[model samples]
Target: MRFQTITTDILVIGGGLAALKATHSASESGMEVLVVSKGTICSGSSFYPLMEALGCQAPTEDPEDNIRLLEEIRESSFQMHDEELTKIYIDEIRDRVAELPAMGIPYRKMQGGRIPCFAKRARDIFIWEDWNAIRNKSYALLKAKDNVRLMEHCTVIDTILHDDHIAGALCIDRQGSLFVISCRSMILATGGFGDLFEHNLNPSDVCGHGHILALDAGAKLVNMEFIQFIPGFMTPRYKVLFSEQILGYCTQVNDAEGRDLLARYLPSSITSRQCLDERSKHGPYTSSDISRYFDIAMMKEINDTGCEKGFNLSYDPKLLEDKREFISIYVDWIRKEQHIDLLGTKHTIAPLAQASNGGIVIDVRCATGVNGLYAAGEVAGSLHGADRHGGNASGSCLVFGHRSGAYASQWAKSCDRQAINTSIARKALTERFEHHRPNRIDADELIKEIRHLMWYHANVVRNERDLVYAKDRIRQLYEDFNPATHMSNPKTIGMAVKADHAARLSMILLECMLLRKESRGPHYREDYPEKNDRSYARRLMVQSTADKDIEYRFT
Candidate 1:
């Protein structure tokens, strides 16, 4: 069957804040834009706001303070960030935050001038009305644009390249129909790889396809080992994230044993109060924090004992007695959302994979090494070195989204149109349908196994032995994958593609993890417990070879 072909000046693959900003910027720059979203606009991880001091770092008049704050952020990333890119982001974040109101985000301002946010010492966090309200408004803005065309329920399978430049992309729409999107420039804003892990806070659709596409197109990816995990709800449905602030107020109890788990792991010298206080500061588990043992204990409990039920987090009712108003306003929302009371109740939670601290390598312009390809938001790497700062992820999305759109639009305007080789796209589609049998592997089963395998071996904690086993198992699964039975179903096909990408990315992540022999930020290893800056301080870079071999280089 001959597939339909659509042409556009710039093709943006994603529908979150980054993609929306990129689309808006590209359209505003007088370039026709086409947005292809796996899900609806603002429906990815960008929609899920973090409770722990989430806000952007806006620029200040004091240059000294800016430098100090940048140093702090670099410290947060474990000193692995691209200095030039960090400087550009630090300089432009305030401007991006300023533009939010115009784009329909109703940021609540406090009494003392600027909008108040939750942060440590720094005060740049701002509260918006809600995710739904902002999403509706942003969707309206994108729909209202005459130059931008939005396609929902579409996934890009392969980026068509001609002579090292992007010619177009092959996509699968909702109805299992394949089509070729011919574009002069492409922007990838497809979020992170949180969904690759079994216990993750991100939506299921974020299966690391952006990294896969970029790698296949001969682009480089960096720091794939550093994924951040935080304490989040495990049972009664995975709806909301357990806030980092809760560590201070709650008691950690092993649900099955009904005993304090931290007491067993932490030294006996420290009292329970001291341990809790230390655990409070290490909510997201930073390597720089001495309290990271709390996180390690949580993981060990689950991993060693097969405690899949996770831990029971409870707070003394007496603690909330004086702060009833604050409890009603803040704590009441979690109860209402989850339909479970907080105080005196053991809310089970474990380390949930939050975000990928690293991703596809990009420059200050959000341009990948590949000429016509640009990446923004979590899809693009080098912004966060070891660990990401609190509010920088959201801010980075807006900042680089604008840059990606502007730069890609300018490239589209200047570059000559490249002719696409239809045979390449045809071959991809043909290979996709090569197997069609009931004896083939189930897409759902494949995805489930990959998710569990990743969480078991390649998740928060890792060792060299487990990583090698995981690599072999993942490679075997990929080699034996059977997408034949569900090839005709678009949804299944999407899952198959993501599963394939997940397998490939898992190998890359394992390799990077094995090479980086130190416990730095989120990438922790039990074998190499110490941070060895003299040897493994630099970032690990990986690129695809001509024969599809992944080659690694540390700089």
Candidate 2:
């Protein structure tokens, strides 16, 4: 196969809000910036709003309120976050959010002003009008810049290293053409691995490829076990995110067999009303509160019956009569945009993988402990701990996205462009495409197997036996699968590469889940039901050794 080489000062490997912010920051320095996306520009997790609008949280201008907000963040994360980074996030998020209005991003205004969605107090959140406005305006603004260029429908397979530092990246377009992206610096904003699960709300291309790329290039990952799972519609509209705000109004929840699923799994001590009330307080499932039983029951039901459709929920609007403020906005949006009437329809809901709370470990400046390599957005880890606040996902995209871009640009300007080594790219291509053996394994089937394994064994509820079995199964799949064998059909090469990365990442995530023996936040181990702060309080870091074996350490 032949290779085409493209040179740039900075290479950004995503098209989400974080990547756009990074590209915007880097372009201001007059450096040529190239953004490569797996889909169209501005299309990632950040642009896929589950509800009528997307919430971006920022501290209120009040000094005392900001202090309270900071404390709440630490409490919500269960002290799993870096205090330095938490402080930076609280101090800078307001200004970053304020800049959005100027870029043509409109905020949803209410009578009492911004309402706190997931927090008790002082956690001010600004909701964007919708995903379409944000994408169009952001795309138009970036396209107007001279130094910024965007390559859509392009997937970056791996990063190339020279003398233990990043030199460039390897990528493939939709047409099966190969390209070598040579750059002085590279930033990863590829989002998370929600797509690895059978049921997830993420885009198809977000399958933890960035995590694998970072690990392959000698960077450490932390909190791989702390994935956030939220309820999503499984019936009428599969994979659509279910609003947690409506959970409180649910009057009845039944399985496909028309049985009381929640009552069967929920302990007798916890009343159904109590459980539903607590569950409505947050979007993601967390063991930190009593609401965890709601998720546990749903998962147990799915596992017991092998019913992928989950449970049908019937709600009464009378329950939300007192919550006029919430109804006026959320319920109205549901009626107008989603075209679903909660009072008239019964919807099926299941626990769907939402976001990753852990990823590549980065410093305050967004450097991933590798020279010329930086990370931002959901792909960058440890800004959040076990559970993240409702809107902090978008907030982090703005803060770290800007930081990674500015810092990568500064680093690139101070250094000379690295020489390109075509041999490295050629060797990688040969190892992946030169095999003469017959292709026995299908990439599509392999991906399906991995997704099923993860959703059943490793998601939401985990135990030693299932996790160990999953780890071994993934390792076996990774060992047996070979993209080179399928080189005759070039269209399948990208899928093979994606499946390979998913298998490797699944192994690492299973290892992390096994290492943390205690249940904390979203990571619940049935065998070890209680949180053991003394034994497993610190963050766990995983990296690839020189021999290509996984090694982990506690910080």
Listed in order, each prediction's TM-score against the native is: 0.92, 0.95
Off by over 4 Å in 1: 49-54, 59-62, 109-120, 318-329, 421-424, 431-440, 482-492
**TM-score, cand. 1 vs. native:** 0.92
Error of 2 at 446 (Å): 0.8
Candidates in order have lDDT scores of 0.77, 0.83
User: Candidate 1, 509: how far from true, in Å?
Assistant: 1.1
Per-residue lDDT tens digits for candidate 2, residues 1-555, read: 667889999999998878888888789899999999999988788877656667677766788877887788788777688778888888998878877765557775344443343466744667776677678888888889899888999888778877777888888899988888889899999999999998999889889999999998899999989999999888666777777867778777888988887788778788888888898888899887778888888898788878888888888767447455555577766666666677776678889998999999999989998999999999998798888887888889989999999999998887777766677787866664426544456788888889999999987889999999988987677666777765545576678789878888998899899999999889999999999989988999999998888998878
Q: How well does candidate 1 score on lDDT at residue 223?
A: 87
Candidate 1 weakest ten by summed lDDT: 110-119
Question: For model 2, which pairs clash?
Answer: none
RMSD per candidate (Å) reads 3.1, 2.1
